[model samples]
Structure formats: structure tokens, C-alpha cells
Target: MLSIEGLRVEVEGKEILKGLDLEVNAGEVHAIMGPNGSGKSTLAHVLAGREGYQISGGKLRYLGLDLQELEIEERAHAGIFLAMQYPVELPGVNNMIFLREALNAIRRARGEPEIDALGFMKQVRDKARELNLDEKLLKRSVNAGFSGGEKKRNEVLQMAMLAPKLAILDETDSGLDIDALRIVADGVNLLRSPERALILVTHYQRLLDYIQPDRVHVLAAGRIVRSGGRELALELEEKGYGWLSEEAAA
Candidate 1:
């Protein structure tokens, strides 16, 4: 569903993604594993059309569209979702209200009719149940006073509701206990379909143990240094990223 070639991104005066290339197809889950500062989050941000990162060179085509030409909202409307590393707190905003508006806005952009209030609530409730999120949290302010696990669960709930064609989850498993991690992973796994694709950007192999990604790519110094199957995550867990970084530098 997505294709990238020789993608280079620069922040400030330095480059973070250097000649990176990646392709994701429908129905496949790809895990991006890397050490700190290896540009995993950068890739997520760039794919979501976040500002400040200059694409100096490369071709990024999403479903045959010129991805770089689309704005952030356009990307979302076009079925691209990014589950942030740190979900933002929208104080004074009702969680359900905020999500409904966002979902309706995307629907509007796509020339679809807005769902009625009752229908929207049913949708949200269904997705929340899928993620094992409490219905009470939907009535509260978005991410306000939420625990770390709550925030991540909220992200997965959004993913389930949105059902994006390409979902980029940046460190969604970070800061979660084992139980919370399992819940989130189960929610993600349930969403896997032949028409959808997922990109999981993470640091540890623990998350992979639950998600069982179809492919694993080790990113270092802004490039995918190695690509392998699910066993690669196990190898990385056993040997650590230090060995991969050395191999990349060599």
C-alpha cells in the first residue's frame, strides 16, 4: 500500500533519515526495530506528514498517490493513521466529542455522510470494547489524568475505530505493564486484515513476541541496515542492537 525509495529527511542542519527505503503491502505487519536515535520515530513522523522534516530526496507513493504532496489532514483523510509515541492531552475536551468530530471530519473530506450521534457512539463503544478500554474514559477529557497504559490503550482504540489503510504505530508498547501490553497487542492483532497494513516502530522485542510481525527491519543511522523475518526480532533480543550498529557502520 506504500512505497518509498531513497528517502532522505533532514531536521535543522543535520539529516536523520539518509537514503532510507521501505515498502509496505496490504495485510502485512512490519516492525521497525532500532536503538535510541536510530530514526524510528522520525520515519513515523515523516510518513504522517508532520512538519519540520524536509524531504530532500526520494519518492514516497501511497496507493499510487504522490504522498509528499498531501497535507497532514489530507493524509488522515486518505486513510493514513499515526499512533503517536506520546498521545497528547486535550484538556477541556470530551474524549468522545473529540473523536467523533475527528472521525466525521475525515468522513466529510471523503464525501461520505457524517454518522449520527447514536451511530457514532455505537462505533466508538464497539472499538473501545475491542481495546478493552473503559466506556467512562470516553466521557472524560482526552488523555487528561490518564495513566501511561490508558493513553496507549486510547491510541489503539482510535486505530480500531479509524481502520486506516496504513497504520503507523510509533512505540505504542512503550511504558506498559505486561497485562496492558497484551491487551494492546490483542487489539492490534484483531485489526489485521487482507486490505490493511501496519507499521510498528519500536525498540524492544517484547512487543514482537505478542504481535508476531511478518517482517522485522533494523534501522540504524537513519537507514534500514538489515531486514529479516520474525526470527530476526528474537535474534536482536538475544544479541542486542550493538552488534547491528557495528555491522551497519562497517
Candidate 2:
């Protein structure tokens, strides 16, 4: 469903992603494990169409459309979802209002009519219940006064509502207890389908325990160095990324 070829990206005149190539087919989940500064988050930002990341070279195709040609909103409307690692706080925007606006924006982009307030509220309630999120959270400001776990849950709620064809989660398992992680994982697992693909960017293998991936890749220095099955994750957890880096250098 998604294909990238020889993608090289740079930010602030510094190259981050160098000759990165990946392909994710429908009904598959791929995990990208890498150490810090390995361009994992950079790949997510570039795919999301965030500004300031200069595409030095290569191509990104999403379901046959040229991803690099689309804007961030366009990507979102095209059924591409990104769960950010750090969700920003919007003090003035009520969570419900923000979500409604986002949903409407996406709907409008797809030539769909805007949903009424009541209908939107019902959808929010239903999604929140499915994700194990509290209804009160919808009434509060976006990420304002929310705990770390709450922020992560809010991200998952957005994913559930958006129902993207390809979901790219950047460190969704960070800063969460086991219980919170399970809830977040459940939200992701529920979204899996034959027509959808998932790319999980993580540092540890703990999150893999909840949501098993079809393939595991170890990325180092902006490139994939090792591709293996689920067992590779366990080995990395036991031995650490240093060995992988050395292997990549070799």
C-alpha cells in the first residue's frame, strides 16, 4: 500500500534520511527499530508532509499516488494517519471542538457534508468508549492539563476516528505503564484490517509484545541494516543496538 525508494531527506542543511527504501503492503504491520538520531522520526515527519524537511532525493508512493506531491492535510485526507510522539497542548481549543473541526476538515476534503454537532458528539463518544478513553476528556482542552497517558490515549482516539488506510505510529509506546500500553495497543490492534497497513517506529521490543508485527527492521544511521522476524526484536532487546550498529558498519 506504501512504497518508498531511495528517499534522502535533509533538515537545516543536515541530511537525516539517506537512501531509505521500504515497502509496506496491505494487511501487514512493520516495525522499525532504531537508535536515537537514526532518522526514524524524520521518516514520519517527511511522510506527514511537515515543512523544513528538504527532500534531497527519491520517491514516496502511497497507494499509487505520489506522496511527496501532497500536503499534510492532503495526506491525512488520503487515509494516511500519523500518531505523534509528543501531542501538543492547545489551551484555548476544547478537545471536542478540535476533533470536530479536524473531522469536518477531512470530510470536506473528501466532498462529504459536515456532520451536525449532535452526530459528531455521538461519534466521539463511541470512539472514546472503544479506545477506553473517558468521555470527560472530550470536553477538556486539547492536551491541556492532560497526563502523559491521557495524551497518548487522545492520539489513539484520533486514529480511531480518522480510520486511515495506513497508520504510522511514532513511539506510541513511550512514557506509558504496562496497563496504559495495553490500552493503546488494543486501540491499534482494533484498527488492523486487510485493506490497511501499519508502520510502528519504536526503540524497544516491549510494544511488540502487545501488537505483533509481520516483519521487523533495524534501522541505523538512516538506513535499514537488518531485516528479520519477531525473534530479532528479542535478540536486540537482550544484546542492544550497539551490536547492530557495528554490524551495519561492517
Candidate 3:
């Protein structure tokens, strides 16, 4: 579903992702784990078409189309979803309304009819309940006054509703406690399908324990230095990233 090859990216004048390469096919879950400043988030942001990042080199393609050619909204409309590490707050914007509009916008782009208010509400309520999200929060401004765990759940809620082809979650587990993490992971697991792929960018292996990945990649120094199965995550958890970083350097 997504192809990244020798992807080099720069923010301002400094390079971040240096010759990174990854391939995620449909029906696969890939976990990207790394320490601080390893360009894990940079890869996520670049794939999401966030501004301020310059693609200095390499190629990125999604569903066989050139990803760099698509604008941010276009990428979203094309079924690319990025659950950010920090979900922004929009004061005065009703969470329900924002989600409905966003979902309908994507639907319309795909030549599908917009979901009616009743259907949308039902869908929202069902997903909110599944995510253990307070129904009252849906009536409030998006992410406003939401706790860290609530914000992460809100991100998962959005992903569930959008049903994107490729979902990139950037540290959805960062601030979540065990219960919240399980709730969020369960919601993410429910979205898993043969037609949908997920790239989870995380710092620790705890998240992987809930949502088992088809492959675990260790990204250090802006590139994937090792790719292995779930055991790799266990190894990382036991041995930490120091060995991997040293190996990459060597």
C-alpha cells in the first residue's frame, strides 16, 4: 500500500531521514521503533505531506502513485490517514461536526454519497463507545480540555471513522496508560483488514504487545538498520536500542 525508497528528507537545512527505505503492503502491520532524533516522526510527517519538510532525495509512492505529487488534502482523500503524536485542539469546533464534515469530504472525493446526519451520528456513537470515548466529548470542541489519553483515543476514533487504506500512527501510545493503551490498541486492531495497512511509529515495545506487527523495524540514524519479526521487538525491549544504534554506526 505504501512504498518508500532511499527516502532522504530535510527540515530547514539539516537532513533528517537519510536513505530510509520501507515497503508496507496491504494486510501488513509494520512497527517502526527508534530512540530520540532517529527520524521516525520525520518519516511519518513526510508521508503525511506536512509542510516545512524538504524531500532532498529518494522516492515515495502510495498505491502506485507518486506520493510527493499529491497535496496534503489529496493524500487524505486518497485514503492516507496520519494519527498525529499530538492531536491539535480546535476551539469552537464541535468534534462531531468536524468529524462528519471530514468524513463526508473524503466520501465525496471518492464519488460516494455523503452520510446523512442520523447515520453519521450512529456511526460516531458506536465508534466512540467502542473506543471508550465519552459521548459528551463529541459535543465539545475537538480535543479541547481532553486529557492526554483522551486525545490519543480521539485520534484512534478519527482513524476508525475514516477507514483509511494506510494508517500512520505516530506514537499513539506515548501518553496513554495501560487501560487507555489497551482501549486504543483494541480499536486499532478492529480496523485491521486485508485491504488496510498500518505503520505504527513508536518509541517502546509495549504498544507492539497489544497490536502485533507483521514486521518490526529498527530505525536509527535516519534509516532502517534492521527488520525482523515480533521477536525483534522483544529483543529491543530486553537489550534496548543501544546495540542497534552501535551496529548501524559500525
Tens-place lDDT digits, model 2, residues 105-206? 999999999999999889889989987888999999999998889999999999888788999999999999999999999999998999999999999999
Q: What is the lDDT of candidate 1?
A: 0.94
User: Which portions of model 3 miss their true places by more than 4 Å?
Assistant: none
Model 3 score (lDDT):
0.96
For each candidate in the order shown, give its overall lDDT on alpha carbons.
Answer: 0.94, 0.93, 0.96
Q: Predictions ranked by lDDT, top down?
A: 3, 1, 2
Give the TM-scores of the predictions, in the order they appear: 0.98, 0.97, 0.99
The digit string of per-residue lDDT tens for model 3 on 86-147 reads: 99999999999999999999999999999999999999999999999999999999999999
Most TM-score-accurate candidate: 3
Please estimate how well model 2 matches the true structure, expressed as its whole-model Cα lDDT: 0.93
Work out candidate 2's RMSD over C-alphas. Answer: 1.0
